[model samples]
Target chain A: AQSVTQLDSHVSVSEGTPVLLRCNYSSSYSPSLFWYVQHPNKGLQLLLKYTSAATLVKGINGFEAEFKKSETSFHLTKPSAHMSDAAEYFCVVSAFGGNRDDKIIFGKGTRLHILP
Target chain B: GAGVSQSPRYKVAKRGQDVALRCDPISGHVSLFWYQQALGQGPEFLTYFQNEAQLDKSGLPSDRFFAERPEGSVSTLKIQRTQQEDSAVYLCASSSPREWGQPQHFGDGTRLSIL
Candidate 1:
């Protein structure tokens, strides 16, 4: 079974400080990993994705994640936290190939808080 | 181009009532997905449709949950005998090719409340 675990349920960062949200995944095969953000009353927005091509992936709003196969981790990071960055973040993983029906497993989610 | 759109932005149903939520995928998107997102939780897959074919529905919690994409462009999810636990935001997303690593565009989602 493929599953994603977000290490923190909540993370608080001061504005302009660096931010890190950790995630680990379990998959039978090489997996496709993604990070998504959701604002209040808004839809989930794709941040970045890792598809075996590159270990380091950069995404919108200065967010990035590194795919570490040995560690079974794909952690999202940002150089500085913005007030608008306060939102719910999710780590998701899906199998590389086979069936289109294969569902993407998601982490519970991490709520980011930015303090000024 | 417009993004995915879900209608009945909000729906409130009583127990035993049947409710239908609709989704309009982006133009030319070949794959559409429906997910159930409970309050304070990540979206859980419910079903997938490739064009007009309903490929997978293993994530559906019960038979009471039914989804259809008859025309391949618009999809509808119907829940019969709504339960209190079913109250949550139902999200709709669509992707271009239905392949791994393809980015999915999402709609705001319909907030369903079961009484």
Candidate 2:
């Protein structure tokens, strides 16, 4: 049984400011983690993923997440926030690092709000 | 052909009505998934299909919920009797066979409202 937890239901930041959305996971096996962004009335877009590779992962739009084994965390970050960055973000844990298990679990979500 | 496409972006139904939702996965994609998302919540897996084989249906809420991918290309989810609790966005996603870690591409989703 794998699961994900998003620390914040919502996070607000000013334009040009750095952003952080925290996530944690629990898996019996090595996990495959992912970040997805969903805009209003739009489909989800992949941000990044970590599958027992490099701890630091870079994604589109300058977004990135670091997989911390000690902390059981994969937190998304950005150096500067843009208005287009306002969207709902999800952290997911795919069972067994995706080689065998395709079952995925999602967090409730973190709604990012960019203030002008 | 550009991406996964779902029919009728929105649907409204009365109690006891049967509704069917369609999903067209990416050309030659091997895996397809169906999920239901409530307001302000992440999508919940309902079922999965590998080609035309329905591999997993464990997440389905009840027997009233059913899904099928007959020709290994298109799939359908049918709700036998609409209920207020069924009012939510139904999302469809598909992934290819290149990598196990490949993220699934999603459709905009169909917002089903039961009245």
Candidate 3:
């Protein structure tokens, strides 16, 4: 079974400070990892994805995540926090090899709060 | 270009009533998916479609839940005999294919309330 675990349910940070949302995944096969952000009453937006091509993946809105196979982690990070960055972040994992029906498992999500 | 779109941004239905949710995937998208998201939780896969074929419905909660993509472009998810537990945000997503690294584009989602 493929699954993702988000370490923090909620994180609060001050503007201009660095941000980190930890995520760990479990999969029997090589996995594809992704980070998505959702604002209140809005659908999820892709932030970044790792497909084994690169370990450090950059995404929209100055966000990025590093895929660490040894650690079984794909933690999202940003150099500095912004008020606009306050939203719920989800870490997702999917199997690389399977039918098109392969399921994507999502983490519980981490709510980010930015204090100005 | 427009992204994946879902109709009826909000739906309120009485228990035992039936409702249908629609989704319009991006042009030329080969894969479509439906997910249910409860309050304070991540989206859970409900079904998947590859073109016009209903490839997977493993995540659907019960037989009352049915999904179809007859044209391969537009899909509908129907729920019968709605229960209070059925209340949640239904999300629709589409991707070009199941190829590794492909990101699924999601719609704003339909917030369903069972009264």
The candidate 2 chain B region of ten consecutive residues with least summed lDDT is: B97-106
lDDT of 1 by residue, A66-97 (tens): 99998999999999999999999999998866
What is the C-alpha DockQ of each candidate? 0.80, 0.79, 0.88
Q: What are the chain B TM-scores of all models? A: 0.97, 0.97, 0.97
Question: Can you tell me which runs of candidate 1 are displaced by over 4 Å?
Answer: none
Clash count per candidate: 0, 0, 0
Question: Which scores greater on DockQ, model 2 or model 3?
Answer: 3
The models' CA-based lDDT, in order, is 0.93, 0.92, 0.94
Model 1, span B54-103: residue lDDT tens: 89998899999999999999999999999999999999999997566787
Q: Residue A46 of candidate 3: its Cα lDDT?
A: 94
The CAPRI class of candidate 1 is medium
Docking class of 2: medium
Q: CA shift at B15, candidate 2, in angstroms?
A: 1.2
Comparing 1 with 2 on DockQ, the higher-scoring candidate is 1
CAPRI accuracy category, model 3 = high
Best by DockQ, which number? Answer: 3
Error of 1 at A3 (Å): 0.7
lDDT of 2 by residue, B49-115 (tens): 9999998899899999999999999999999988999999999999997465778889999999999
Model 3 spans > 4 angstroms off: A99-101
